[model samples]
Structure formats: structure tokens, C-alpha cells
Target chain A: MLITRVKKKDAILSLCKGKTLLIACFGCKEVHFEEKEYQALKEDLKTSNLNISGEIQLDYLCNDDYTNKRFELHKKEIDEAETIIIFSCGVGVQTFAGLIPGKTVLSGCDTYVLPGFSGFTPSSHDCEQCGECMLGFTVGICPVTACSKGLLNGQCGGAKKGKCEVSKNKDCGWERIYNRMTVLKKDDLTLKKMIRVRNYNK
Target chain B: MHFTELTKMGKFVITSELGPPKGFHIEKALHEAELVWPHVHAINVTDNQSSVMRLSGLAMCKVLKDKNIEPVFQVTCRDRNRLALQSDILSAALFGIDNLLLLTGDHTTLGDHKDAKPVFDLDSVSLAYMVKHLEEGKDLAGNALDGEPPKFCKGAVVSPCAEPLEPQLFKMEKKIKAGIQFFQTQAVYEADKFEKFMKRVKEFGVPVYVGIVVLKSVGMARFMNENVAGINVPDNIIEELKKDKEKTKSGQTGIEISARLIKELKPLCQGVHLMPLGWDDKVPEILKLSGIIAEKG
Candidate 1:
């Protein structure tokens, strides 16, 4: 699932200062999309100078076929409005803009994405998609994404107290790899082998 | 001694860089190579260094080889795909070039030819691994090589004074794992920090040739500080350069400073990789002043 957050309310207000139509994606496929946060922004827009001509709660706005059908169903309401604000990620906003030419399609949300797992549910884990995957060798903990230094072999000397030397807040990925490997009875998963460079194009 | 030979002999190896001319100024490139060849163990040929197009580094290495000067062929990942990179390894070997330095080159947009597409099919680490594979007589796809494997003294670049130093350290480990035998650091001015960095790097057990870029003027130092990513020039060095108004005096002072840095960093590092920044002829003076070589009678 893709992650997203609302654009600044003040900027959205100015973009929709005139009569406008609000297309909100209620069915955002994030592990946890702040539905109430969007509701709060809608409340604030109600108090602003922008007159809401119509509102459509969209599901899977990034789906071009579904979006096309929805737009056709609400053609009268959309054409009547001066500006259209799509409350979703960049993909949804781009889809609306590309599908409806000459329409004022403004993005109400900014895309905050990580490399998403295909299966549903939000995860803090992100795979940089560096083509080559070394998860099996490192006991499933990704050093490429988790480690501050992105080291493939042993950890740099900077790791202290199982925390990253660069990013103090983050856990050292190598430490986790070590601990996990110990648990799995694989004491030497990372031993005696030189890990090659990660290729991101994969 | 050659670079690897000197380092292995524990003789505090010294290497210097030589930028091939941007145009087909073959004579000028040869002249520059001849100028710095004697003072250092080996001359590193730049691969269109700083993202500016120039004569290819492999060609320059062949040039230096013909002159009986050992060359470290610097290869960048910015211009070539994996196939080209592997092929270049064979070509460098066939040309009798043994030293190889791999780098993730500067973006093409940083160069004059912005429109040219950058083929980053392999980064520095990957390229280093590919070279290792070539040495092992196998291609990246695990295919058998046609003949004898290429032999090389592999090296890579590092920036020890990087603001967040861990990333650089991390990549250094990766380079080592990829079979890199040596390293050349970016311009380093923080002597204390570099000492600490080298102390940590010693555990990796590879020779690092500390990079000393001669800063000839306050403007040049400031330009590097602002424009270059990992190079950090201390204010005192900048103020020292600013003290001298005469170009000759400042240039001489720059050489002294570079020599001093080399002398100070000698204990912590295995060698010095001098980057003279167009002042290629001053290399001998720097070596003499740094006590790496003796003054003439």
C-alpha cells in the first residue's frame, strides 16, 4: 500500500478559494491512512472562502478505469465547478489530470511513499528495490534499506549499543541481522563471503 | 616501485593524479604525465574527472605505459554499462595496465554534455565486483572466460571527512568486500578527524592513500567548499591562502600546505595521493618538502 499525507491546508484553501468540487479518496490502500485527518481538512475548507459545489467519495482513484467511470457518472457536477481538487496521492491526481484534459485538477495530498509490499497492510519496512535481494543471506533483515551506511558485509565501527552511528534514532540493521541469525541457528550467515554492490535499477 | 609494490613493501607509497587533456592534446597529456611520474610511485589517470569530458582514462593509461610509467587506470560507472565495464577490464589487462580504480562518477548534468545519457548500469561497488569476477575468469552471469583471467591491483575512492561519516565508511567496507585492495580518499583538511577515521579504517586492513588537493587560492578553497560534496577545507587554510596576494607566493604556500598535510597524515595512512589542480609541475617540490623525497644537490 502507498503512503500519503494531506497537503498544507492553507495552500489547498488558496487553490480552492473559488467555487470548487472536492474528490476525496476514502478508499486509500495505506496500512493506515488518517481518515479523520482528511475529515478535519474538509471541515476547515467548509469554514474557508471556497464554496463546495459538490463532493464525491472515490475508491481507488489511482485506478484509471474506475476513475474514468466515476468522472463520467459525475460529469455534470465536475463540469459545473470552476476547480477540481483530488485528495489522494500524486498518482491519483496525475490520473485525473491526464484523463480530463483542460480541467483544473489540483492535488490536495502529497505522496509519501515507501517501496510497498504487494500484500496489503502498512509496514515501516521499505525495500529500495536495488534489483538484487540479499534477504536470505542476512536472515531476512535488510541492511541495504535499514542500515544507515547500507553496508553488505560486517557492520562499520560506528555502530554503538545496537543503534546506528549516523541516525541515532534508528536501530543498527547489522546488529539486528546478527541477533536474528543467532536465533535462527545460523551463526555464520554473513561470514566468509564478500557481498557485492547493490544495483537499484532491479 | 609500482603503487601496490611500494605499499606491500611498506615504503609509505606516494601517487599523483594526471588529468588527460579535454581535447586531443596528446603531447600536453604526455608532458604532464612525464612531469609528475618520477615523484610518485604511479600516476592516476582521471576518467573525465569532475564530470567534464576529456580523453579516456584507459587511453591515457596506455600512453603512460608506453612511456614506461606505471598507470592506475581510473574507471567511472557513469558512462558505461556492465558489459562495457567488464570489457574495459580485459582491454586494460591486455594493454599491460595492472592498477585499476573504480568510482561512481559525477552525474552527466555536472558536465558540459548535459544531454548525453548516463549509463549507471553498474555503480562503483558493482563495477569493483565485476572486475573481481574478471580476475576470477568468469563474467557477471557466471559464464566461463575464454582464456587467462585479468590481474589487477584494485582500488577505490573514499571521503573520510564527509559530514555523516558512517555512509562513507560503510561503502568502504563494501568496496573491500568487492575485492578492492587499496583506497584514495577525497581532499582532507581536518587532520584530527582524519586520524580518527584512519584509526577505524585500519581494521579493514587495506592501504589508503590520503588525498591532498593543493588549494592555490582562497577562491579555489571556497569554490571547493561550496561546490564539492565531501571535501572540507578548514578556515585556517583558507585564511593562510588569503594572506598571500602574489600568485607565485600563494601557489608555493599551497604546495607547502599540501606537503605539511602529507607529512602529518603519513603515520595514519599508507601513502599520499597528490592532486595538484593544474599545478602539476609543483609535485616534485611537494614531495621534497614533505620529506617523501630528498632535495637535489
Candidate 2:
């Protein structure tokens, strides 16, 4: 999932209290880091006694060409700030780090690789990005991400009422996988553990 | 007899699990499988159940096969990549191991090998697809086999009682599309809920074997409730076990409870898969209580 949570808000403010540049990509809407979170962050920064040089909402900071274009447009602000703070996913943060060598860069959010629904909003469903897609066979469920145990073959001994043993808040991923297969009239495809080994690169 | 034959003859299928030992000590597991004979249509030799290192499901399946025991060999995506999986599948078929159960194995974090890199090369769904490809005489890459392709009585898993049930429902449908022949579900304690879920499952008309793990005690049920993912033991069952532990012998109570569950589930599903969870000997007794004959005199 893209930047699910932000960390070290005070640490960010302390470092960029004066003459600091802020670059954010709260895009990707629902799944990625949202703009409302950054808006709240801006409100917090106003009371922190910081000399804000300028803020750049780098559109799709993960893209190199677009980032460069934005960089060219914000050269004056870049020159004025003493430090750079990023509030996008790790990819966007890395892009800025590579773009600005001399400047001290700070990450505003921590990115999680586990997928969330819709690339932008955090939906209950997730994808493991295991390369081989099983949703076609599993009735659109992703066991790699859904099951806490990630059991490829069957349900664990610990599952209770179709909820996962590890976390009560989360539904048992396998339970959902089975029910989905049943509804789709594909339960026969599940008799044998079909796992032939996944090609991670795929 | 093969599970297919048993089900075809209208015999309510009964299957149980045999966990391979942590080391290569296969004697105990082999012995256990033999002892469970006649009662169960086949024995599911687990592949590293609970992510704990054990003899591979295929190796144990071979061991069981040598003894003429039908083994449901388990395969998981947590350890191997595609080539290794394909090679092993062929090997299992060569050894006459026909039954298989695919899984997205538990995360390596839950096992003793937590530090080892986990290889979730495929989820259970993709694995099911791979099996279908093999059955069609072609590899996942579309390469046709030189001779007759291997045949297997494929079994997939389902956890019926999980909440927010839509995703599991969808995945079950996909598995059918992928060509799974049968389904053995996760541990289920509540028959009413399972029946309700089956009401929806009936839409597909698949043979679904309800999973039943013998509950030993209140602590065991509570631990499962607290630690495991994707299964919940209702409080009433827990309360029954608690009373059993506090006031009577838990072993007898567990048998009664599990047998009661099986009896209730008999008419609702195709079969029952009993996972003793190390309580292998109790399986026969549990079966007996549920009116399941252990042997044909």
C-alpha cells in the first residue's frame, strides 16, 4: 500500500523550522496518501515557528520526467530552502533524493508494500504482487494479502468462525477465498492445492 | 478407496490429517496413517502445518503410498518458486501420489524459520490454475506433455464462517473455474453459521468437506481465538470446553463436542475432514461418537 501513515511530525518540523522546502504528492487519492492528511500537517506546521520557503505538490513524484519538469519550475524555491521534506511514497522520496544530491532530504510518510484497494484509497482488499495472478481461479480474492497466515493450500487449525486468529479485526482471508470460489461455481478447481510455485518476477 | 469413489458411492467422506514430523522421522507418521485406516477415505499429510518445518508433504505422501494409504499431499507457495513446484508435482505423480491440497503457506514469521526468506511464489488460487494446466497436458507456460498427463483428485480449501464473507465467496467461485474437484474447509465450530454459508455455497453445487479440529480445552480454543488468523471459535463452544476442563475430563468432552459438530454437519455438506492437531489417536473415538464406523467387520 502507498504511504499508509506519516511519522515523526515533530521531528520533521524541528528540522525544517526555518528556511525549509516542503514537497508533497498527496495524490493517488483514496489509496495513496490523501491531501487531507497533508492539509492537517500544514496546519500543524503553521504554529511551529518555521520560515516556510515554499510548498511544491509534485504531481506524481514517482515519475522521473514529471519530477524533473516540476524541479525546473521550482528552481527558485529549491535555492531558497535549506532543507527538503517529502510527503509522498518511498518512490517519490527516492526520486527527490536522487534529484537533489546536496540538500538534506526527509521522508514524511512510510510506504508499505502490501497493497490496498484502488491504488489510491485504502480498501479492505489488498494484493500481494506475487506476479502470478490467482484471482481468476479464486473468484477475485487475493490470499497472499488476505490470509494472515497466507496459507496457499487450506485453512489453518486456528481459524475461528472465518476470522483470522492473529487479528480479530481482519476477516479470515481463506474463508473469504473459499466462499468466493463457491459462489462463482468454481469450487471444483480448489480440490487439490493448485500451487505450482509462483514466479516472483512475473 | 479414493475419496471420489467414496463420495460417488454416496458414502459420506471422512478424511483426516497426519502431520509429518519436524525431522525426517517418518516412522511415526506412517504408523499413524495406517492406524487411521478404514475409518478415513484418505489421509492428508500436511506440508509444514503451522509453518513449522516438517517432512515435506510429498515425501510423506510417498511414504503413505508405499503402504497403500491414500495420501492428500499438501503443497504451499511459501517455500518454492515455479520450477521447483512443477518438478515436485511431476515427482509426486510419478510416485503415484494422486491427491493434492494447495495453499498459500503461513508467513515464515509464525514458524521456527522466521529469519529465512519467505517465497510466496503463488497463492492457492494461482496454484489451482497451475494444477488445471497440468491436467490439460500442458505446463503453466503452455508446453504440452510428451506422454499422458498426470491425473489427480484435486482438493482445495475454504473457510466458510469468516466475516465479510464476500471475498471468500468470490475466491471459491474462481477455484471452481480453475477446475478444483473438491473443497475441504478450515476449522468450523458453528454449524448454524456454516449451514447459512452453505445455503450460499449450494449455488455452485460442489462437494465441500467441512473441517473439524478437535477442541482439547478452553485454553486451546482461547489460544486459537487469540492467535490464529482466519478462524474464530464461538464463545459458546469455548464455554462448553471451559466447563469440561473445570468440571470433567476434557478429552471425553472434546470428543462429544467434535462429534456433535460432525453429526450436525453431516447433512449440510459432502464430508468431514478431521484435523486432530496432534491428537491423532482421538480421531477414531471422535468418529465412533459421531456414528462413523472405524472398520468394516
Candidate 3:
């Protein structure tokens, strides 16, 4: 149901009667532009545009309130929308997919649009939203985002000269940890503080 | 009144940052202010820290000032245009709160409302100049105010050890030219780095207050390193922190490190600006380490 302008012909050709679609714009602001692009998309249907006949609703969430909303609302959106197109980057898109039970298409915002990478699909049911948000405990580096190996409690020892082994430009989590300790003036005490493994299991 | 006089009179130079609550809980924000009134020299109400809207910084500063805590209003240039920015500065002076910390706040992209549109009114340097011009009874466009402008104890921020320290120093020079009386730096973890930064600028003769942010947890320490720009954390220390987890949980490990930094840096600077973050109660412990008692002068 989340068809891009590029796939408009195919989308209209295979339209189902009772299906509902939801276009989500969260975390990124390029949604305005994306919305504009979709307005200009070529339509091959008899109606010329993919019309949802009032059953479809558009719900948008920016970073401000989206990060803290109740999961029930997100669940309702997913259930209502036959197809969802998300314009966001990184874990936000993936997390939204995890919250909703269905397939979703991903698009990057203008600022986040990396060269050659179009979007991503859910590879596996990776995160089990254990009712705990540990972005703080992890020093802002999500194990799901930066760490390719997905080691939770500790970082992989694969950094050379502050770059990650997998992606040379990517900073190894430990390098960030070291820099953070120095700025806080707790260099000597950095090694002493222990953070327990955050359990995000459902 | 001058900040020096307030400090000299044995009046506690108490300061606090008004973190606007997540919701429309003005009473809760006031309650937070009351908790620190007895100990603060001034309550510094921040203007939409990280550029996310919560409460108006000016209104909150006025509210705290009404409650008898001197308000050191913080103004950042991330949102306002110059005209609005200057008008707000004058309005703050008219409202009677004197202390100010001019900051070039977080980028608009970093905040919750990225699409909310950003207006880089002016950088901290120009803001400092604006403050000076108003003090001289002139507007930014050279128009003179109707009456005598108010005097303010204007201050600015700098991270001496930031990756590129020269720009900060250059800005400091501009602030000095713009009539800044004091400076508070980003948190100081490395006394040696601060000492080196101070050594180069001692000739400026401004009373530099080294920012001392007490690390509440190892996680907090690592968060600052990763997210906060212009902050550098050494490697060996992170390795050590990773190895010894048991001793740090009680926070004694952090306290000791803070005490050591304070003890070393106390002699080189005018005074320490202890940023407790949320841990304001431990300030006394830090004061003890710096050998600074409640000044009776």
C-alpha cells in the first residue's frame, strides 16, 4: 500500500477495495518535499490519483512528541493503515516498524539522504521493546544503530584510531566513551563506573 | 548591584538553571526554583535549551526573580533575529534581572522541532556587542535609547580545550571588546588543559570561572563525550572506568575526581562554577574540595 511515485502504475493496477494506507513523517522534515513529490506523481488509474475514499487518514509525528507517545496510538495507526510510507532515518523507522504489525517502506529526509541508499526493509524481529528506553545508558549510541555486531553491554574491540572496523568513518563506541569521560572531568573515575546491561526484552 | 559586591558582602553567590519542565507545570517549575532559592546567588533561566520549546526563558526568569532569587537570564541566538534578540535583552534589563550568559545555542537540527524553522539572530559575539551597545544607550542600528540604559553583569561561555580552541579564544577577545566582565567555560575535566588555556589568556584580565560539572554516573560521563561537541575525553581513563564498575556506583569515585580538579584549578582562576546538573545537593562536597567556604567578605 505504501507505493512511491515511481511505482504508481503498479500500485494503481493492483489496488484492493478495502485497503487503507497511512503516510508517516517522523524524525525528519523532508516529508513536506516528499509530499510535494507525490502530488506530482504520474497516475495511470481511471481516477488518476490513488484515492482512499475517506477511509485513509494522514497522521504525522515530528521528533518533539513522537519519541514519548504511548505505544497504543502507534499501534492504532499501523492497524488502520493498509500501507505505511515512513520518511525517517535509522532506528526511528525501524522502531516504528517493530511497533506496527506489517510491512513498511522507508525513505530518508533531505539531510539524511545518503548517496545510493534508497531505503530499508525489516530484516528480522530484532528488538523486543522491553519497556525500557536505554538511549541514555548507552551514551546515545544505540547498539541497534552503530554496532554492527549488536553487542549490548560492551562495545566490540574493533576500533583503530577512533574509527570502527566495519565502517572506518564510524566511531567505535569505546572511543566516544573515552572522549566523554575527559570532558566530564572524571577521567580517573571513568573506569570505575559500571553500567548494567539494559534489558529491552518484551 | 555588581556581582563582585554581591559576592563580597557574604551574600551567597547562589546560581541555578531553570530547566522548563516537560509539560505545562509552572507550579512544578516554581517548586524546583524554591528548592534552590536558599542557596543560590541567582537563578539562570535558560532559553529553550537545545532549542526545543518548553517555557519562555524571559518569563521564567521574571517569575524566579519575583520569588526573590536573583535571575541570571540566559539568551541564545539560535532562535531570535537581531531585532527581537536586542529587544528581549532590553526588556530583561527593564525587568531588573542583571546577570546574563550569552550563548550560541544548539543547532536547530538537534532540537525536537527541526521543522520549526531556525533564525540565527546573531552569534554570541554579536550578542555581547549588542549588550554593550544597549548599555551605552544605543540600539544595534545606532539609534539611542530614550533614557539611560541599565548596567548588566554580562558573561559569556567558552570551551578552552575544544578541538579548535582558537575560535573560542578569538570570540573571547570579541566579548572582551564588547564589554563582557566574566566567562564560564564548558565543564572542566582536564585541569591541565584548562590551565594551558588560561595561561594564554591571563593577559585579558577577565575573571574566568572554570566550569566544574560533577559526573553523577559513568553513563552520564560517556553521554557527554559522545553527544556534546567541543568536548574531548581521554582514552586510558575510559578503559579504567570500564574495568572498575563497583566503586563508581556509589559516586564517590566521581566526587574524588571533581575534588581533585577543583583543588588543582582553584588557584589559577577567579572561582569555580560548579554545575551540579541535577545533583545540586553535592555542591557542598565540591566546595569543600576546592577549599572555598561560604565567603564572609
Candidate 4:
């Protein structure tokens, strides 16, 4: 489950000058939302003289059909609102914006990563789906997700003592790749082969 | 006039870095450049080195060129997009500056301007590729140049002392494939490790210059050990610096240490890139002490 933090009250208040519709997605199963903080936000908004046209809290806001159905049910309230504030992951905000065109859809929350298991399953590795997979050559360590900079060419000169400079707790992805390649006795061959430059268009 | 020609003739090339000042007063900076002129073959004008805002490297290169000193134009992907980078490349060419050092600059967060947006539109490898395309009279979009396309002697950076060194080697090979003519490595403090690194780098057939950064004091050494990436200043060097109880003379000790490293590293690589880190006046001393050049009369 993606970890999210609510945007500052003042910043959220600024985007919601007119009558605003609020859609807060608690996310799918196993996701955690700070109910106290969210409730405090609604109370603060009310105290700040914000016109709350409608409030809808639901799960799976990224699901287009589910979100569209929810919108239909709240059509009257949605129609009256001048701004739509979605408190969810980036994907959910984008999905809402995509469904309702020409509307000021603003994100009320920011998404952050929690190291492992970014997808549905509880796995050690996560793929960013960068289109071109270097996992085969890298012996399964995904550099795009693992490296803080998402450097594709190789390791930047930022890793120190097997740990990443950006995040001290994290292992240097290229160091892991190097160690794995050595274990498999593929380092020599890997060194000879030119690493393909990342196709940014992909 | 390419310094690469010296490498072709098997001369042990010597280069140094010149950080553009934060403000417009460039008299001291120019004097610093002249101080090392008798010692170094070329000077690399840093492009916001360490992510700190400074005078434009291209502008400084032009200034250095006016003094007849060969300048290596250092460009980073941290500040500009493809359009601005291409424009600047052509502009550098227009000024008759041909030597280029392409780098994926340190992140913007590391600099004085922490809130600045970093634009890594083209990395060093891709920038080298773009330069190759530009040399062929084409821009990145295949647009033809109005005049003679710029030809540059392009160089790139590598971290030879990186832990699990194969990834750096992999990238180095890719850079060479991307038409990078030479390489200047990240600060190296260990001789044995660099010797091993050079053994692999030699197969690539590109001139690899060992970078020697002067460690100013015990604090600086410890700071780099804890903070800087890929630079591991061994405890022995720190102990050596600490032995110089006169903190004022630490600069002298730092010069001694750098000269010693350059002396040890001279045989292992094609050249030495001295990064004195504001100790510009000490470069001639370091060069003379390392036996790179004779003592001036």
C-alpha cells in the first residue's frame, strides 16, 4: 500500500477558495490512513470558512468505474462545487482529473515510498515498469527503483560504504548489482558489454 | 591544441580545476589560473562544482581563453535542458573553446540553492552522444546547423575507487563507446585500489586521469570520509594530518599528502587531475614536490 501524507491546511485551503468537493480515498486493503489527522483537517477547513459542498470517502479511487459510479451518486453536490480536492495517491488524483475534464482537480495529499512491496503482493522487489528491463543483465536488482536518482547508465559517484548517499539506510543498488554479478561470475562479461543508454521516451 | 595530443605522445598530462567565483571580482581567480599555468597543461573550469552557484563555466572559459590558457569547458546536466545545453555547446564553439568535460552534476539539493529544480534532461553519456551528433553537423532533433558544426575533444568523469567497481567500469565503457575521448576520475586517496582500477581501465584504450583532491585538514578529511561519496580517506592519512599539530601548517601537510599521492599515482594512470580546492597557489609546490615539473628559478 502507498503511504500518503495530507497536504498542509493552508495550502489545501488556498486551492479550495470556492465551494469544494472533497474525495478522500483510504486506499485498498492493508492501507493505513490517519483518521484523526483527516478529521482534524475537515474541522479546520470548516473553521477556516471553507464551503464544503460535498465530502465523499471511499476505497479504490484509482478504479475508474468505481470512482465514476461514486461521482454519479454525488452528481448534484459535484455539480455545485467549483473545485475538486482528492486526498489520495497520485494515481487516484490523476484518475479523478481524467474522468472530469475542465475541472480544477487538486491533490490534497503527497505520496511516499516504503522501501519494499510497492505492488499488490508482499514481495522484496518492485518494478517501476520502465519498459526496458535491465534485470536480466543486473542479476535482478532493479536500478531504476533501487537507485535514488533512477540512474540507468550505472552507479553515480554517490554511494558510500555500500549505502546510498540519498538514503543512508538503503544499500547502494549498483553495489548489490556488482556483488550479484560477481557471485554469478558474470562481472567480466558485464564489464565488456556496453550498458544501453536509457530511452527516456520509453 | 587538444591536450589529448599530449596523451597520444605518451606525455604525463597534468590538469587542474578552477572554480569560478561566487561574484564578479575575477582578478584573484585569473591570478590563480596564472599561478598554475607553468605547471598544468589545461584547467577545467567547474560548472557549479559541488552544486554551488557560481560564475558560468563557459564565461570563465572565454575569460581564460583571452589569457591564452587552454580551458576545458565543464558542462553539467543539472542546470539545463537539451535545448539550452545544445545552444551553449554551439556558443562555446563560437568562442573557439573546444575542450569539453561533460558531467552529470551533483544534485541540486547538495548545493547552496537547495530549492532549485534539477534538470537532468541529458546525462553525461547522452550528452557525449549529443556532442558526437553535433560534431556531425546535426542537433539532437536532426536539424542541420547554419554554419560549421563544432568539433570538441570531449572528456567524462569516472569513479575508479567505487566499491564494487564493476558498475563504474561498465559506465566507463559505455562512455568510451559514446565517444568520450578521455576520463577524469573522482577523488582517489588509496593507491592500491587505484592501481587495481587502472589495470581494468587500461584495456579501454582511453587516457584515464587520476584525480587528487588536496585534503585541507583533519576535519576536511573526516568530513569527506563521512559525507562525500566514493571517496574513502583512509585513517592513516587522517592520522598523518593530525600529526601536524600546528593547524596553520595543515595546508603544508595537505600539500605534502597530495604530492605524495600524485607521486605514487603517476605511474598507474595517463595523467593526474589536481583539485586543490582553493589551494590554487599550492599547486606549483605540489607539482614540484611530486616531481611533475622542476623547481622554478
Q: Provide fnat values for all models in the order shown.
A: 0.11, 0.32, 0.00, 0.51
Reference-based TM-score of each model = 0.65, 0.66, 0.56, 0.71
- B1-297: candidate 4 lDDT, tens digit per residue: 676788887788889999999998899899999998888888999999988999999999999999988899999988998889999999999888979999878878788998998777677777888899899999988899888878899999999887767778877878888889999999999999999998887788899899999988887888998888878899999998888668526488888889899999988888999898889999998888999852122
Off by over 4 Å in 2: A1-58, A61-202, B246-250, B294-297
> What DockQ does each prediction reach against the true complex?
0.08, 0.16, 0.01, 0.29
DockQ of candidate 1 (2 decimals): 0.08
lDDT of 1 by residue, B109-186 (tens): 668887888665666777788888988999987899998887889999888886556546766877888889999988
Off by over 4 Å in 3: A1-202, B4-16, B37-40, B235-250
Instruction: Name the better of 1 and 3 by DockQ.
Output: 1
- lDDT by residue for model 3 (B1-297), tens: 556565445343434466766666688778766765555456677788866787878888888777776777888877787789888888888888888888767656567887766554456666777788888989877898988887899987777666545435645676677677878777777777888999989998877777777766667778777756555556544554566577566556666677777788877776566666655556566666656554432
Interface RMSD of each: 8.1, 6.3, 19.3, 2.3
Report residue A25 deviation for candidate 3 (angstroms).
45
Give the CA lDDT, 0 to 100, for residue B146 in model 3: 88
What is the lDDT, from 0 to 100, of the residue B6 in candidate 4? 82
- Here the TM-score of candidate 3's chain B is 0.87
Candidate 4 lDDT, A1-202, residue by residue in tens: 4566676787677545479888899877534456678888988888889988879888777677878898798888777887778776655665676566545566676555455666362234444544444443444455676776666666777778888876778888777766665654542354344545555554
Task: List pairs with backbone clashes in candidate 4.
Answer: none
Which candidate do you rate higher for TM-score, 2 or 4?
Answer: 4
Interface RMSD of 3: 19.3
**Best lDDT among the predictions, by candidate number:** 4
Give the per-residue Cα lDDT of candidate 4 at B93: 94
Ranked by TM-score, the better of candidates 1 and 2 is: 2
Q: For model 2, report DockQ.
A: 0.16
